[model samples]
Target: MFTGLSAFPLIPTDENGIDEQAFVGLVARLAAAGVASIGALGSTGGYAYLSREQRALTAREAVAAAGTTPVIVGIGALRTRQVLDHAADAHEAGAAAVLLAPMSYQPLTDDEVFGLYRTVTAETTIPLVVYDNPGTTHVTFSDELHGRIAALPNIGSIKIPGVAAAAAPARIAALRAVIPAHVTIGVSGDWLAAGGLLGGADAWYSVLGGLFPEAALAITRATQASDSTAAREASNRLEPLWALFQRYGSLRVMSAAAETLGLVHSPNLPLPLLGLDPAGRSELEATLLRLGLGA
Candidate 1:
């Protein structure tokens, strides 16, 4: 469940709320593409914006649509109680695993973050993925903190943020030395996925994979086959898309891409968030066409 490409699809929505049909189509598309897992309600899925009921619905639909593919649902919330509730909901939905990011309005301390994991893991039977995305959650995890949280039962995987290509090997090695051997290390940051995989990370918790699994899987398979050159080449081929993600943030870029592909209606993001502007959309369309990703 923790290895290979875990595609995190966007939970398409509009003023009427979650577009269940589009969301299910995204999940089914990923399942058919043979991604290692379908990561619904992750950062890409806009889990933080949805109500508990909405999130639970998304989880149930993702698992159902994914069929044989493993489904990892994000269960992050501001409060531990809410997180526990979300975890229970995910378990009830028959999710293969749950991903948790330490989300907070007030900055959290290392101990506070550790306590969050300890409480959830102690109460839930489902496996947890520690999402270390400082970019979004604003909670950073030191190697020491990661080791402590990973020591808790049900700590299945750690989804680490991107490291530079030069540092990936040492970073992964350092992480491996501290955590239990059973606990896998998955890499986020789509641009750095190939480097992370080649550097010995166990999985790619990918944004691009959610929309375009075939492109992401090419890199994953090349890495699995010990073809480092192929993996790097595959990643490099998507550099233009990666550049767009870096410029506009993945959520917005992916929303625009989904709309362009007609997978979902325009203005798919949640309230207070808007899709790309005209110029950005034009650029994205050109890039997509150049990459042979046009609808």
Candidate 2:
């Protein structure tokens, strides 16, 4: 009955890349802190920049760190085989589920999008989480497409980004209204936990869970208990941290936030990302301090 949940931010590495042991340790900490799941190599985790090998290695380490908890592997790519390969890797790595978004290279027609999800679903036996984040991937799967995908047996769930949180309840209810009860609808916004829960999402894929699982878990539990007051209180307390996602775009800020929280070695990002500048760093630090999460 995980009607609400949180996931660790998959922070990327500098030049040499993420330390396997350190990454595993981060997941272990998240698991200990009560996170229901872990997401590695995501936008927050810099999935796009990771080499295929790095992605697989990160998945393996994440699954190992999760131990008993579920690991949701991000499998968005330009090619279907690549996504299938990631899903296969997740299965091999002992992941509980796989999350995927549409390919970013080309715009897909509704029929094409449905076909892609159907094809991917056919390849994997594990539970799948369809990702809908128009911000990063540039396109979103329509509700019709989502319903079509949700109808499949192995299509376990869908994780809509936070921007959709306000509209999620009715939208999800509409989707669920057509599909069976087995498929779940989840949200990926760190600040939208309460709204997502209230809106009827089954779980939350949190970016903050990696650095502050305690706060994320507390808020989720409060929402699940139907304590709107407490949920709002926790969400308010977390506003400063969630604002960090807005300060610098998602990926770079996530790394910077990880650095501010001392979850990672440095704020160094991959080429083209080049980490954050001084102003960005100061904003990140201010957000951290305001949230009482000292840098």
Candidate 3:
């Protein structure tokens, strides 16, 4: 489940809360596209902003909608107990696995982060993916810390942040040496996925794949077939989208894309988080049309 394209879809929401119909449609689309797994409630899914009830409902809906494709539900929360509760909810929802990011308001120590994983692994029955997204979580996992956590029960895959293309091979090698053989290394950051895969990363936990599975699969399959040129070319084709992600952040840009593509209605993001500005939206729409992704 962890060793291929895992699409992390946005969980569309409005003032009334989760838009189940739109969210289910998104999951079903990924399933039909034959993505190896569907990641629900990940950072792209706006998990951190949702309440427990909303997240649980999203998990259930995603699992139900995904059919045979695996569903990996994110169970990250500020508190350990809350995370455990979310994990249990994911288990009850029939998630194939759970993704855990060490979320923190206060800056966390290496030991504290390790302890968080220890506690969650001790309690949860579902296999957990270590989500190392420092950009949002504010908690970084050193390779040594990852080794420690990977040794814990239920640690199935480690989702690492993006590294430069040149450094990808060595970066993946270093992680491979520390972590156990059974624990797969999944790359986040869509732009880095091709390099990471070519460098020996096992899977792609991709935000872009969630919205455009065929496009992401093009890169993933090309890399899997050992066609580096094709993979790089595929990734290069999306350079404009990656730039937009860098400029406005993936969540905001993707929300706008979803609206532009008519997958969801406007004001799709949770309150306190806004979509892309007019100029950014215009630029994104133009880029999308150039790439043949505009609605």
Candidate 4:
């Protein structure tokens, strides 16, 4: 059901807990920029670092701030039961959908992954989007696995990581051909969005879209209209940002951009995940300026 760009804004926070005011403003900004949906607790939102109460509170506050914008809450956990509980909490918080990733401390088998989704789908009535992000989950969904999960009742969509250069369009086509008619295939990784959108991805579950929705949405609208020239032009404007993503990390770059824009304060990300390097700050600032987003 996610047809175009969906924004995954950072859950702004400091050392103490969620910064409700900053978080609300971030979500409101994305909504105002006209993103298709607001995804709370996504990669940028630091779902793993938060406690149960914090996650629930963030989802609740996000929904309230989003106004009429649809909210998709992330509920990925190592344990299936924990995910179910989070999904229920998201549902109660008035979320429009829930996103699930196969995050594990212990290495997981295909069967374990399958069972996790099966159990979550059985217990949760809210629509679930399978997030096939091997970068974070350390578990990749095989072609067969993608089809199986998509067919499950209420499995509304799958957000796939963008593939290699040559594989995008064909891979998207293959995934679409196999997944149930009701299941949408979304693409993540901002750099891969151009090829994925041109290739027929149903949605762009985007990090950049959260920071600058109008720019990202311009690409979405252009791609949807099959205006390859415009799409490439918009995407070209992001070359510096994409390079930062490749060199530093999406979280680091996004946090830096958000802070530079005065959209939110530099968030206190979870342990082990550090802030954007001071060494790279000037470079990022230059990129931001070139993109016409004043630093």
lDDT of 4 by residue, 10-34 (tens): 8766677777888899999988888
Instruction: Output the lDDT of residue 242, model 3.
Output: 99
Each candidate structure's count of clashing pairs: 0, 1, 0, 0
User: What ordering of candidates by lDDT runs from best to worst?
Assistant: 1, 3, 4, 2
Winner by lDDT between candidate 3 and candidate 1:
1
For model 3, how does the per-residue alpha-carbon lDDT over 62-115 read when each residue is reduced to its tens digit? 999999999999999999999999999999999999999999999999999999
Ranking by TM-score: 1, 3, 4, 2
Give model 4's TM-score versus the native structure: 0.97
Q: Model-by-model lDDT, in order?
A: 0.94, 0.75, 0.94, 0.87
Model 4, position 135, has a per-residue lDDT of 87
Q: TM-scores of all models?
A: 0.99, 0.92, 0.99, 0.97
* Tens-digit per-residue lDDT, 1-295, candidate 2: 2245757565557777766665776788888876777777677777877878888888888887777877888888888888888888878887777888886677777787787789988988887788888877777676777778788768877777674546867866877776668877777767776787767777877777776787788878887788878877988887766676666665667677667666677645777676678888898788777777674
Summarize candidate 1's per-residue lDDT along 1-295 as a digit string, tens digits.
9999999999987778999999999999999999999999999999998999999999999999999999998999999999999999999999999999999899999999999999999998988999999988899899999999999999999999988778999999999999999999999899999999999999999999999999999999999998999999999999999999999999999999999999999779988899999999999999999999886
lDDT (Cα) of model 3: 0.94
Model 3 bad stretches (over 4 Å)? none
Predicted structure 1, TM vs. truth: 0.99
Model 1 segments beyond 4 Å from truth? none
By lDDT, the best candidate is: 1
Candidate with the larger TM-score of 1 and 2: 1
